[model samples]
Target: MGEACERPGSTEDCVDDAVCATDASETGDPADPVWETYTCRAVCVDESDCPEGQECRGVTGAFATRACQPLR
Candidate 1:
């Protein structure tokens, strides 16, 4: 549930029930996919919707996606 949406190329909008978020690190040469910073996390309703050892939690940023993240 960490992939992007249904588009042909870059600059895609999140599909229904998904949100765009960033989690990037510096690359020696940043040019396109060499250093991608955006991710699509699934919006979960509760723990039941998550896999084992994970729980539905709000995404790190101000986004509305509630992804199933591993316990802290």
Candidate 2:
């Protein structure tokens, strides 16, 4: 299984595309939200793929995973 980087500051060094966004859960479960790893993933760029109130965004300036997150 891929390493889980749920924390904000956590970053994957040396990765070619190590950018990820947070996928928030409604239940507020303790388990971390799934981190979608990607290489120029569509969900990262296409806001249309994101659920309501969430938008596709990058993480840590890296391009590892693109995930859905609430507007900031």
Candidate 3:
């Protein structure tokens, strides 16, 4: 198994109140490792802090956005 596969439980091990993200590494010409890491909700202070393709929507909390929309 690869490095990523070895840590399948890493995400689940995080505290329930905190968010989790996955850090993946890819092999290529130069063996580009750890290309990027997708964050969950742990490091986010606001919706705008989310990645470009994702959005932070609140239901019973603050009246933030309602859903994640496409980035134009």
Candidate 4:
């Protein structure tokens, strides 16, 4: 895959068809800036598609598109 995405908006630079996905659990809290980080993940068909410690999940808004993510 390409380099890990450092920003929070787009995944155009991610390799291996990966997209930039934000951690849902990390968001919604104005007090936490750590949640602003984005991860480069390939779209997943199931949990198996995710890395060992993560799982495939779908969010509701702009992040709604399914991708590999940490378990919530």
Candidate 5:
């Protein structure tokens, strides 16, 4: 569910229950500058909908789309 994708891309680019959402996690290497990547992630309504260590997060404004995100 972590496949890289283009911004504002189509949902067809992801799996059946996933969307091309922004990966909110930190970079693999701390030495690297913070960069944003669009990845395929499962949609969720709340923390209960995500995996054990993830949560459903959105920007909390108009047009904000929620997706499963890692808590760490």
Candidate 6:
């Protein structure tokens, strides 16, 4: 299988594929400062590993995607 096809259990296990730059603001202006981007891999191992107000949602290649939602 190809290297990209391999999956990691967690973000710590992910190898950076690219160093993308993201604007610091929502305006999407190029003049804005750039932020480093990490490969979209599992950022957390479990729900408890997520932030206090966020939940982990599974992504295609990532173990989970951290999303914030109101408590039910």
Q: TM-score winner among the candidates? A: 5
lDDT per residue as tens, model 6, 1-72: 112222333333334531111113334555763433223322444677555764544443333343222122
TM-score of each: 0.46, 0.37, 0.24, 0.58, 0.66, 0.28
The runs of at least 3 residues in candidate 5 whose Cα sits more than 4 Å from the true structure, single-residue gaps closed, are 8-10, 24-33, 59-64
Residue 67 in model 1: lDDT? 64
Higher-ranked by TM-score: 3 or 6: 6
Instruction: Give the range where candidate 6 is weakest over 10 consecutive residues by summed lDDT.
Output: 17-26
The runs of at least 3 residues in candidate 6 whose Cα sits more than 4 Å from the true structure, single-residue gaps closed, are 1-42, 61-72
Give the least accurate 10-residue stretch of model 1, judged by summed lDDT. Answer: 4-13
What stretches of model 4 exceed 4 Å from their correct place?
A: 1-9, 24-34, 59-64
Give the winner by TM-score: 1 or 2.
1
- Candidate 2: C-alpha lDDT: 0.46
Better of 4 and 5 by lDDT: 5
Q: Determine the C-alpha RMSD for candidate 3 after optimal superposition of all C-alphas.
A: 10.8
lDDT of 1 by residue, 1-72 (tens): 466533312224665666554443465544442424666655678999877887777765544457665554
Q: 6-68, model 2: which lDDT tens digit per residue?
A: 444234422343333344444544475544442222234568876687667765454555655
Superior by TM-score: candidate 2 or candidate 5: 5
**What does candidate 1 score on TM?**
0.46
Better of 3 and 6 by lDDT: 3
Ranking by lDDT: 5, 4, 1, 2, 3, 6
| Model 3 TM-score (2 dp) | 0.24
In model 1, which runs have C-alpha deviations exceeding 4 angstroms? Answer: 4-12, 22-37, 63-65
User: For model 2, what is the error of residue 13's alpha carbon versus the real structure, in angstroms, after optimal superposition?
Assistant: 15
